[model samples]
Target: MSKIVMFDMDGTLLDLSFDDFIWNECLPERHAKIHQLPLSESKEKLYQFYQSHRHTLVWYSSTYWTKTVGVDVLKLQQEFQSKIQARSGCIELLQQLKEQGYICWLVTNADRASLRLKLDNIAIEHFFDVIISSEQVGYAKEDINFWQELQRLHPFNPDETIFIDDTATVLKTAEKFGIQHLFNISQPSSLKDIKQHQDLEFKTLDRLTELLSILNEIDRKDNDVKIA
Candidate 1:
């Protein structure tokens, strides 16, 4: 099997955070302005409502936000696409890994449309061999089935693959699916105490080049023969 590296997009390859930037700043602000609600009151209420339904489309969809927030989903999604990147640094890491021999891929929970908007805005689509989201898999990353499906599509052996994400729950699910290699992101806020189970867990790196160098050395050593 080919050596493959799969990364979670939201907090691992991209920046850590729930991407509330749009809901917190843009969407509510736009809705308040357009609907003539008190800007401060609207921003406050909308932000609070968004927080209430965090990790859900229940508030953001026509079934909910359209009635409660009084805005079109299409329009709000457009507005969200306008302010996509709330943080930085991951694009450079992606570039470095792509230049190295590793076949990099992205596995995320973000829905397809939102995922496309983020990738398009960042102009980093070409780096990934494939982008799979939990929505398409019909399960969250917490389920072993999600990764079993990933294997069905990509066909990479668990031994040769390293999966990285910010959630321990999902990492455990990966292990259940037979992925022995895993990394919980090192960022404190995103940290999941992955040390006991991970091959490597580092918060910051001077360069991805360093990772590549280590991999090269391992490959060279593995290829060298030993006298019995």
Candidate 2:
């Protein structure tokens, strides 16, 4: 069987500016109005709240944030749908992966409604063979148990699977769980510059052809070992 390649949606395959706009600007503005607080104050308070729950399940839960911040997040997502876009070369990379024998999956922390909205807005839903959300598994990617449960429900060879993501925290968690091939996206959003990381990292999907070469080399090495 061909190797499976899993991707993180927001930053790995899609541009992350829409999410940044919603969290930093759109939601904060509405939150200030609802509470009669100054825009600056609301933004600071929300940032603190986000910091407190950085890697937890609540951090990614739209339902939790909707009730906590008193704003309709999905509605705001729709309003800012125009900002949804694919990262440069991401669509072409997906096309190339399809042409090859690899399987593609979308593994994200985004809620189902949010995922559907973004997919519709970007029109890239057909590229994935499977879509799994943290909401469905009841654990965030930062949690080691999340990876364990993911393996149970959707079996894939850890040695043959390649996971790419933008978040350093979640990538570390996946690494701890014994996943062999891990790649980090240093620049998930165009607004951000490339970040330095100790692990295998790339600034854009344009280097994915290089990754194919690496995987092919690994397969050849494994085949030679088996023959010996």
Off by over 4 Å in 2: 197-210
**Where in model 1 is the C-alpha error above 4 Å?**
24-74, 80-82, 86-89, 188-228
RMSD of each: 5.6, 2.2
Least accurate stretch of 10 residues (summed lDDT) in model 2?
199-208
Residue-pair clashes per candidate: 0, 0
**What's model 2's lDDT at 64?**
85
TM-score per model over all chains: 0.66, 0.92
**Top of the candidates by TM-score:** 2
lDDT of candidate 2 over 75-100, digit per residue (tens)? 88898898898888788777888788
lDDT by residue for model 1 over 1-228, one digit each (tens)? 346878787666654333545555666677888888887888888768877875443532343666677766445656656555523456666677777667888888776666776787767778888888777776677777788887887788886676777666778788888875666655522323423434444222333233455556645654673331
